[model samples]
Target: MQDGTTVRDVMHRAFLGVSESDTLGDAAELMLAEGADCLVVVRGGEPVGCLSPRDALGAILDGADPGETTVDEVMAPPAPTVPADSRIAAAEERLVAEGSSRLVVTRDGEAVGILTERDVLAAGTTHPSAGAEHAVRGSAADVGAAEEAAVDAESADAPTAEATQSICEVCGTLTAELSPSNGQMLCPDCQEV
Candidate 1:
């Protein structure tokens, strides 16, 4: 990854937000339409929480009615966040420590964008020694097989392989681990859930 790179450099510029009063079903529909894996829950134009598809699924699994359950009742607390100017290394540390796949990007106490693992990987791939660490973990053939499996699982509906902007249909966040299965794009976490 680039030295001294900040959250702002890797965060997704476009993000989705929903009112706390919005129904779970509404949030899910918005996620599908926007191809987003998460939605910030806002009130008075300020973020209050976050809704992911997993949250909705959990509620539904517990018998909550999607159309009637409100975001406030199902959303997770606002995502672990980082200042836009914070270093990517710091953000990476936070993600690891918190066991989170993404973080809300903030500026001047306001929500801005989102930083994700995919962004970090993309940065790492551009560095001169990108393959050094992975090279130690496996043979070239092992790497090739992994890459082939990933390609075979990608959604045909995805606009391009280079488009990291696509959201995980199961989790509602844009991540590099998404794979299409049974017509739904699922992130690795969502796949297990």
Candidate 2:
């Protein structure tokens, strides 16, 4: 999902917005009407939190009246922000560190888009830079799998067994975690200029 793919490349440029003071019923209705999986909760025109479908569902199942509950009461805290220029891999790391499934993409501290787990998964399936993605992940098995898939899609020749089983030649930090680069196998860390 990475490999030079910036947050801007995969983030949703258009996201639905909801007011923090709005009734949960109203927010849920808006989500349904817009076919939105999540909504940006706002207060005074500023983003305050994120409202995912799970949040709404939990409130409903808890016997809370959506009409009486406010979005703030059910919404998760504000999502972590990543600059639009940030790498998807870094953003993915932040998502894990924050234990959040979504990230708010911003530029100059102003929200410009949103990135979700779904978007990352979609990119992984369609992105052509699979080898690079796996290299960054530091796993030979992953690199081999991604390479095999790429070769099959393009009908390229199969790589040597060593390519899939070797460690980084430049840095011994990883075992069986090298990717071909300029005819040499190197870990992503070593590939950095």
Alpha-carbon lDDT, every model: 0.71, 0.70
Clashes of 2: 0
**For residue 193, what is the lDDT in candidate 1?**
61
Per-residue lDDT tens digits for candidate 1, residues 1-193, read: 4467788887998889899999999889998899877898877656789998889889989999989999999898988888999987688677656657788888877788888866655554221222222211133344345444444444343435453333466544545557878899787777886
What's the alpha carbon RMSD for model 1? 10.0
lDDT tens per residue, model 2, 1-193: 4368888998999888888889999999999998887898877546789887879989999997999999989998878888999887677667656655578888877778998754554455333432432322335455456656555544443343222233355543323456778887786657874
Count of backbone clashes for each model? 3, 0
Model 1: clashing residue pairs? 37-172, 37-173, 38-172
Q: After superposition, which runs of candidate 2 have C-alpha atoms over 4 Å from their true positions?
A: 1-4, 121-193
List runs of model 1 lying over 4 Å from the truth.
125-193
